[model samples]
Target: MNARLSGDEKRGGACGTDNAGLTTSTGPRPRRRPPVPEESHLLKNAAIALAAAGTLLLASCGSSTAPSGGGRSVVDAAPCARSTAPEAQGMPSTERIFGWIEDLVGIGYRRTGTLEGEKAAAYVKCQFESLGLQDVHYETAKSWNWSATRSRLKVNGEAVDSFPVAHTYVTLDQPSVFSTGPDGLTAEIVDVGAGVPLQSVQGKIVMFDLKFLMPPALLALQIEFLWDPGLTTLEPTLVIGNPFVTSYATAVERAMEGGAVGFIGVLSDYFDSNKYYNEFYRRTQVTIPGVWVTKKEGARIRQMMGGGNRSANLVMEGFRKEATGRAVVGFLPGKSKDTIMVQSHHDSVFYGAVEDGSGTAAVLAQAQYYASQPAESRQKTMMFATFDTHFSGYQVHREFVRKYVIDKETPYNIVANVTLEHIGKQGIKGADDQLEITDKPELRAIIENMGPTLKLGMINSVIRHDLRRTALISGHVLCPIGALPTDAGFICAAGVPTASLIAGPNYLYDAADTLDKVAKDDLVPVTKVFIDLIDAIDATPTALIGLPLKSPLYESGAQD
Candidate 1:
């Protein structure tokens, strides 16, 4: 899983470290660091440093009582403690919130619909209900369930060792065997390095070096490169620079269009490790049979193609039907009954202990904190949701929003939707060091005031989330939220306003994306930021236009 890149190879790059040690990839250079032990210590120290000011407040409040000699309790002289303010009392303690995250990671991965996933959902519901919020329940939806069984690659009909690329939509189907026909589609080997353009793919199985550098342009001739001609018929035909050049969907579309059946791609520097697997699993959709060969295999393929062979046979198999999963939901109605939605997905590809267990924990901790507060302290009703099937084309999210939040006759005035995902890992190399705020300026300012205590920086980048669906279909201000780039990209594509925040680095989709990756200290600040954001939103007097008005209490039970 480790690939060494020389200094020249790593120029203008970000360095990344993983369980496989360290490496570089395409895109941006990862911020490099020392060994894990040192890094962990530094993170722990950073947490301590951040909490130093807050700890002093607790120190000043502590006092000891003494007993009277006559068996009667006697009051001991002590400095007057700081008054417990409403904000302090309403917000859950940092330790309590982080403890919940720890508890969740212990539960392992909760893949949608499994006993674990359901159990995690139930835990979330109970936390919401315990907060004294009313009408908490679960919303079920039909969804497709998928999991990879096995993946392998072979060269010249011989098995070559390989690893499953993250987020790659894989098929259980037999591998497609493609070969150059006897008449031999021949051409000189052209290394159209990275960033291959479409026009250059005429009759060759375009071979590009997997180096981080962009490839040289192909020379035009009477060459027949391996390109699906059918793609040429489409408006804005598939461009070569798109990272999805190797996507199964693109491949199948081209194949059916009677384009070049022989397709090959050099694994990008991004594939130096498996850390992106989870994100990949969540985003990739497979439509064709494909395999990811090693660098060596790619080089060999280039050699054979250079000798002028154009035909290849490919075999593919493995198909399954779609099914259903559930998104557990519960509500705590506030005095006003206008809503504030809090959400997290309960599913994971592997034991997504940190990918989202940390997120789920944050929501639950917030729920518990909100529940402990007096009834009147909360201005808006809070909806606690654990979405299922987020990875399966967002089916559950689409259906749930349409049925509950969007199409209702008496629409709830929702101020915001706060979603938490992948908040456990430390910062990754080349990752943005800010919480992407997708709200209007007024709301963004309110959030900014609460940022420092949580160690959160700000990124005003336009991104998407599941909330986008609610906003688009219902015109609600849905704030799509999370901590990683790929997930943020996914959310942005869905068109929801996104707030991206990361507690850790790029352990994203790898096997290293485990409980160990989560930093206990990061949870406290994240929880604090979320709680404050909710309060700030609730404090707004004017509701967004087009929401339903409140009905009289006496008419509460009347059916519409």
Candidate 2:
């Protein structure tokens, strides 16, 4: 018998009055020393002294609240306190897992379909196998084919070094030259504020300061927010400097279709020579001739553009092709033979230590830990999958879900489909809206209990990610969209009930997303949360009563 929750059934009180699970702490927990007024005054004096010593600071220091009778400062009081089981230990260790991630980053950029990418896949496969996972395999999918040869910029015949942003278009032999129009192609420099508005950018290279100087998160968020709305109306033929926009593909397509001659993206000031060189050589192509200018060079160009240096030369060279990528798959069978799927993508844009490497590691570790459990402890069959081509059309995911998941004729019902994306960062920001489906109260209870253990918040409303697709198809409750820096939130669009864990190291896509960004302390807790969630789901009785068996005639046909 096939058992599933109807759309209406799934829309009930999944987020009921589980106030017992909620904490009412209004401030941060106190674990250390009480506040000292005298010390605060001394610190203020010290700050003034330091400033007099020719140092400038931008500190947001504040006065501390008086201590309570218990000798704990108001600022140091615990906001939320809950009882823990005596035998229950904290979540799994993220440090050990990050060590493995560091080793993977050491392998360099795992561009889709490359030898390095495949080798990385193999290493991941081995890791899963070592964890005792069964039927481990790789699935190939298509990826964009493009590579960069060389990029350079020149002003007044002076050569400048440049970096190539990923997915930016490059021209092979044609170098684009810019000139101010009317007589010599001259236009007044205009600060279009945020570059989202391109109404007045016609016939001139629109310049903006969207390049993030410190943390790339600011830029990533700006780009993600702007690209979806700005791309359609902004019609600048040429754009200069990284405006913190989406994929270079979008910019290139816009510029090309808009009749823009060329683009000059400014590299972030945080670019490391070694890292940039490593990542630059690892560039993949999309559609246009775009190049990255160094911070210094970009500054010079900005000055020249400001000073009416209308005649500037830019050139980019590259080509695109249709390439193939792969997704890895493995399975662990259970008593009922029904499948409960767990998935994370293996491919990445850069080193991707946090974007998804952390998620991948978590899934692999959970599979290992669960497989190590005694056979009697197992309940439903577990499907472990690492999808590919997530960055492109989400081809592999769509194919897999359509074929092996939804199309299966057996009584192999999908109890839960958990998809992990980016989960190695701190601070969870859920989607703008809550899912309309009703959640299984039992599942919500487990999640609530696990939240404190994992240092996570059980948010009712959040954005959709990879698992959203499955939710749409299966209509399962408890759908979660993992927190990350990117738009990997479309998973819930498919209607799969999902829940995501947030533990990312930093904003994704930028060079700052190295293995070092992942917090060692956060890993294990996130892992434990996933493991606990799986256990809870597996323990839930399937809504159905009978299990389907394969027939001898079907077996014979399969053999033939």
Candidate 3:
């Protein structure tokens, strides 16, 4: 995640910086004010603002509308093939994309290692089967199931607000709980900074008050934007992690290393409104027993620190045994062994309509499109792979690579990999996790009022590095390959050129990422572009798709 794009700041979004949910790598990355980094405390638009160097390439504006920055037209410089924009052509019905999204959402959430995950897998299998594709089947993998069946909390014999974190356990079955009462956990409560120092919280029940504060640079940039809306004076910088992928588990891990007995992270004002009931990191394991509390509850706990009756209790049970994960694979044969793999993660924290439902739909939609094409239309093999355990760290992707791409000496001949991620929205998240949709020029609101955080991030990330390009015009094809840890990360690590198509949604990793969060109409262009991506790569000679191995991050050996 420390990789730099030429002269830009180090953006982990393209690399495997976790929080890989979408707003898409660990979980989807959240959106910020603009180009200003998330730590800048400025605003959401600032993160995307950095791309404003007047060379902004917008997908919604189409090629007809040439985006002008610095009084210049960039339509001619776009990477898309002007002769034939196959990926941008043949738009699909919004209803079809919406229907797939709704069906996946209808099955509740698609969290990995859960029944919901399997259901989603089955549905994807059915979709591939209905398309009349060849050799469609389920690919099984394995991962630990860190389920939170029961978590009870109390303060001085009085029940209080609390919920168990994903892997807040000591052992798989005998994980410890947090309780403070006459007979429960009666340690001295220590109120400290975000991640309490080792000396400050050693041997105590550390309480970390969380604050979604932006960095100083972002804060200053945001103030500047308030004074100017059109904002042509400053260059657009790269947006930091939309929400800056803060991990409670990582914070708790630090606390544990500091000698703390128990840990509790209090949600800030941001979560109180935008994501009050978020269950983060359910797909990943935790090293310590932990839970989250509201800001109000945190204050109360802090106030009771010195009180004689101050105490609490946490009882968490129901740690399930290891589980079997599944991945759905479908292939449309071509004349040769050269394979172009297109994938998306089916597992999500919530319904994840935009976070990944849109991605899955894009894959299916592309399948439908290619299926309609003549058999000889494709010269290389096209694969639609929807994976699970993405929440647990892209295990399905790794397994697929090992079996299909690297099993034999000659390999499966996978030349290019495309990952379909969060798409079709109209907003980016700002300070306090606020959704700002009405302000920016890059944010294309496909479904009316909602924002397209994921799409917006993608536009800025892949194109911002191109110093010569300015606007995203018609036939402006971008090389999707990068150093980011995307769904195609495993394949890319194996030296196969990869491109990840995703956007940031404000509530990507939480339950709030529901059906309404997705802009149905936006799906048309996102899917169309995806089609063109497949067509573009397939039509190009394998040697031309640029695969940059600039950093060790390109080495794909880890699970995600």
TM-scores across all candidates?
A: 0.54, 0.56, 0.67
TM-score of 1: 0.54
User: Over the stretch 141-228, how does candidate 3's per-residue lDDT look in tens digits?
Assistant: 7764556666666666667677665556545333343233334444556667565455756666777865543321232321211212
Worst 10 residues of 2 by lDDT: 15-24
Please identify model 1 stretches exceeding 4 Å from their true place.
Answer: 1-109, 113-115, 129-133, 164-267, 274-285, 293-319, 409-411, 426-505, 544-560
Ranking by TM-score: 3, 2, 1
Model 3: CA > 4 A from native: 1-91, 156-158, 170-186, 200-202, 210-244, 247-250, 273-285, 304-310, 408-411, 424-485, 548-560
* Tens digit per residue, CA lDDT, model 2, 367-486: 656666676677888878776565544556555544554465444555555666554333111233111111110000111112222212212111111111011111122222221222
Model 2: how far residue 479 lies from native, Å: 8.3
Q: What lDDT does the true structure give each of the candidates?
A: 0.40, 0.42, 0.53
Query: Which is the winner by lDDT between candidate 2 and candidate 3?
Result: 3
Which candidate wins on TM-score? 3
**Model 3 lDDT at residue 550:** 25
Could you tell me how far off, in angstroms, the CA of residue 112 lies in candidate 1 after the best superposition? 3.2
lDDT of 2: 0.42
lDDT at 311 for candidate 3?
60
Estimate, for each residue in 234-290, the C-alpha lDDT of model 1 and write its tens digit. 221111121211333333234323333333445544334322342323333443333
